[model samples]
Target: MAIPRLRPLLLVAVLLLRAFASLPTQAAARGGLDPSPGIADRKHGSSSRSLLQDQPEITEEMVRGYMSNFELESAIQDFGRRCANISRTYSIGKSVNGSPLWAIEISDKPGQREAEPAFKFIGNVHGDEPVGREVLMQLAYWLCDNYLKDPLAALIVENTHLHILPSMNPDGFALRRRGNANNVDLNRDFPDQFFPNNDDIKHRQPETRAIMNWIKQEHFTASASLHGGALVANYPWDGSRDTRKQYYGCPDDKTFRYMASLYSQSHYNMSLSKEFEGGITNGALWYPIYGGMQDWNYIHGGCFELTLEISDVKWPKASELLVIWKQNKMSMLNLVASLVKTGVHGRIFAADTGRPIPGSLMVKGIDSKINASGSFGDYHRILAPGQSYEVVASMEGYRPKRTRVMLGREATNLDFILDPDGAVRRTKPLRNDCGCSCNDNSNTGKPFLLREAYLWLYLLALFFLLALYLLFRRRMALRLAAHRHPPPKRPVAV
Candidate 1:
């Protein structure tokens, strides 16, 4: 009687265990589970500190000078109202403590999507580094104030969609800690290329998930996250496969270097840094960190991102915020302007349909690929200035087109119209015409057939699983009834 009662429960437990056992482990996934507490301060000679060390306590004195969460929210809302013509305010998501993660989008057409490339500036990734949040607000207002009067400002406003999220980890900001409300470091919360376990979306923190979703929706061409504690422009790859502290360069190393140099050279004194050559360093070389946001942005979001450490002191006095903003103002403006002033912008279309085809763009010798927009089939490829590149546009069922062009200081516009593979095949005669004598037909049709077969197989398996679950429940109910009311043993007439 006891055995029957425990059987169903035991089976259910076994199934659940099996299901969870299939989940990827941290070691198997190749990502670190915990945040790199000291990695942010590695350049400041604090790499030897323990990961569990208590964060610097924030006192009433510290809170006295900085803007509270309420004040920052008010400032953002006020900016939206004051710059209504050029900006739109929206919440990306909420932080762990339910603080709305607000963003200010600045463009001539603030809410609408255009054929132009989009750029994002995220600040205050860590709660204690509030300098970026303040500086970003200043950057927004300055652009609004000087759009028509300043050529660089006017160019950025008219040509690009600039999205600024002044604070990513607002809960951390309110708590005066490096991590969010749950004590998760938002910077190390992203999925890492070296560590696959971090790729589990369900386990990611709310702030990290919000950023991931935002990047997917925005289709940003390039972005930067502002930080404190150092004065260097850092670019990916942020970590190494062997977990060693060394230089690791991604496919777009040259382009990233160019972007980083643009910011450092434009700054008042960043280029003069004695530690980092030209005030720029590869992220891994500076200090290796797994699940960092910069590398993930480049690998997954298709947005080239630079981690800009703008100040030497983290949590600098609020009075010095304005001066810090001034020091980095030109660097900020020039970085955004580089999107429109440089790069190769173009669209892809089908020659026969005369309609846009969502294709991909690739450069010769560069392993990375840039995808075109689905709606307009437009693409923006950022490259170092004064170079020649072979750009290729490709899509399924269409012939790939390749072209060579010289990119100067100004952006080049290139378009591609691809001919259908079948159309090209029609021009040539086959040796035999049994309607199966074509290589192109076999190449395309097999994939479609395989896809359809897989769809049916998935549906069938789902139905079978549902039926098995129902049968198990029915058997458990019948067994419970037998246990509750024992049948008379009168049938023992052997």
Candidate 2:
């Protein structure tokens, strides 16, 4: 019995050794760790030849003209000093290696919160693709130099709050690789709606976490990331369910196409692409990817983001960088201007109290919803120009409002002052799917009962303060009485 068992064990060991011997070195070591899907698969030689493939070895001469990490930071600080009136420099967070992630915000009122729509341009999402970082610096300086003289630049600067994050992955840039210092791709590090690979927040990269926090804090209306290795404007639905490479679109698919077309059409020759029709392609359609920043922005950040591949070469000769900027200049300007030039923008308020309310907005027939800013009750909805749309505004405890508008080439202004729920006053207030606190009465479905109001909030705060004051005064009077009028019978016990 012991000899028979030994024979079977020897046979199993032989098969295991053969299997391990036949595996590719990279694949064997990886062991399905990072799929490194999407962009890495495009035209590269090698996890991520996907985004920035076909580039020569990253030699010092290759990156000679490109700004070093120190030079990039100096340029940022210089921009803040030179354009001090219209720009402010700040750090969002740090990279894994403690590289300061610097950002420049440019507007008529920099560093101040306003009701204007905010648009951000994130460059160098892939450290190896440094074209974006340089181009973004160009964009910032252009707006600074031409704020009043150029009409398009002026429109963007005055009507919108523009933010520029020159490089999102500095460590990756320094390493001359696609991923960060930890070798994780920043683009694929975001949380994916289709998969749970990045659901563990504790394991997210520092750069990715910084971006997520910034999105929630600033609440940008629209944004775009720059890339290379191809020349096309890529929109959302980056990855499809079942991991299939096909066209899967988000609810705002039409709006996204229109926005992408603006960038492509404005480019010097991007719209004339032979590969991408009209120089624009849906992300999933072009190449399906998981945990892409574009899709995550739309789903979680309420930001309409586009992944723009502006160059055919990843790390082109630094001499070619200016031409790249000049080619994409109009496209960038047009996209930012579109926020104020064409779209639906306004504030929401409670009808009775006349204060801003956190009302949610949705377009008829579109599945996605836009949440108005809690600070100003402000929302911006981008749509195709020269089209008709049915827009609806609703909040818990408030009567919903809907309207039809024929949107023109210029941006439209629409404000909704919703009345509190009154139809069913017998029910309780509850939170709705839109993250709004709604008071719902069960008696025949009534609306409006004051769940999210600045006026009610102020009043409740005042009432609590008054009650606190009275309680404190009453206690003081009792203390004084006890000190002045002591009981006489207690002395005998002592």
Candidate 3:
């Protein structure tokens, strides 16, 4: 009898098992093992990965190994050498203990800071959160190395300039403490409702002084402070007890959410969305913390800011360095993507007053989205545009102004004057077929809430994989059938 066909089937099964072994246990728990419907495990096993458990564990030896073994300076220098039209700048500032604070500015378009939206990425904001420093170095290197190879990296560098400060508090990092050399928490030093002015608290620290000056002079579009010790991406305006919390985000909730969502999607956590359920907060990941850099950036600098608590490790280990890099490397890219791609970039004004509209102004249309023209009647949206947009302008007492504009053409611009007459008791919100979470809640019937881009990408990838598998299976079957059935060798003899 011919050899059994079971051998080939067994070989295919082994190859599949090896492929799945590389995926983390958590992915298996979440039903991600099956790349396709035929291959997925039917029975459930407790194999899910915990968001909190994914980060590397820290220890004294791990810290020492990272410091002594890894030549960070060399890694950064090598990265800088790989890209064209990219240069690095070092901003030397003093730490609380008079130590040198090394900051790097990575840009493809030199001296074009004024033209592009400046973005600042600061790491090691808290001494215990040392992982930020590693991730940023990796980011700097990857960006430079991949600029020519990756279109996205090239586009980001060409359109937006990045200022990456790998270590904001060198002294604190060196000391391995949460506070600066003066033993004060740098995060708490920001001027807030609780702490006003540089007077009593006196924000005289060199790190703060240098960055504050840079932020004011450059007019950065957005910024993120990189820290570890937590797994969630925390956002600003934390002092508000309810919705009216004064210290919470600076008069623009829509802008904040647009940027925050970018960070959430690039990471592996969903708890980032549950702010009211204790998953999100201001001070905490998903919660707003008062006296934070994010609040200061919005209130003082007029920039959107986000805090990235990179990893769950208290003091991350050197071995976990690559893991952190994988988790965080895409966030800055996503940030750049949001700045370059999304948002409604315009100003709202009153029709009668000819003054910029102040208070809540909603811009909508067929897209089923709403862009809030903040207190200054200035709304810059990174939102999706569609065929037509219906805009409504409203203030506490001012009558609402309503109009429609088609946005399918070039950039859409609309200015309105509100009459003394009050409009119909506020119209319903906008809706769109696009899976944009900003203002449009359309497609709720679909049940699944995946992003439009993600859904499309998923479908494309699934189709490609299915085709490859079918081709391989067909080839194997043909080979097996040929072996099982003897060729018509006897025909010649007949």
Identify the leading candidate in terms of lDDT: 2
lDDT of 3 by residue, 442-484 (tens): 2222221222433465456556656766767788878889889
Model 3, C-alpha of 489: deviation from truth (Å): 99
Measured on C-alpha atoms, candidate 2 has an lDDT of 0.80
TM-score of each: 0.76, 0.77, 0.57
Candidate 2 off by > 4 Å: 1-55, 423-494
RMSD of each: 19.3, 20.4, 24.6
Score each candidate by Cα lDDT.
Answer: 0.79, 0.80, 0.55
Candidate topping TM-score: 2
The per-candidate count of clashes, in order, stands at 4, 16, 32
Compute the lDDT of residue 415 as modeled in candidate 1: 63
TM-score of 2: 0.77
Per-residue lDDT of model 2, residues 339-439, tens digit only? 88787777776655557777888888889998988877888889887888877888988887656667877777766656676632332233222223332
Per-residue lDDT tens digits for candidate 1, residues 127-175, read 8888999899999999999998998888888888999999999999988
Please say which candidate is ahead in lDDT: 1 or 3: 1
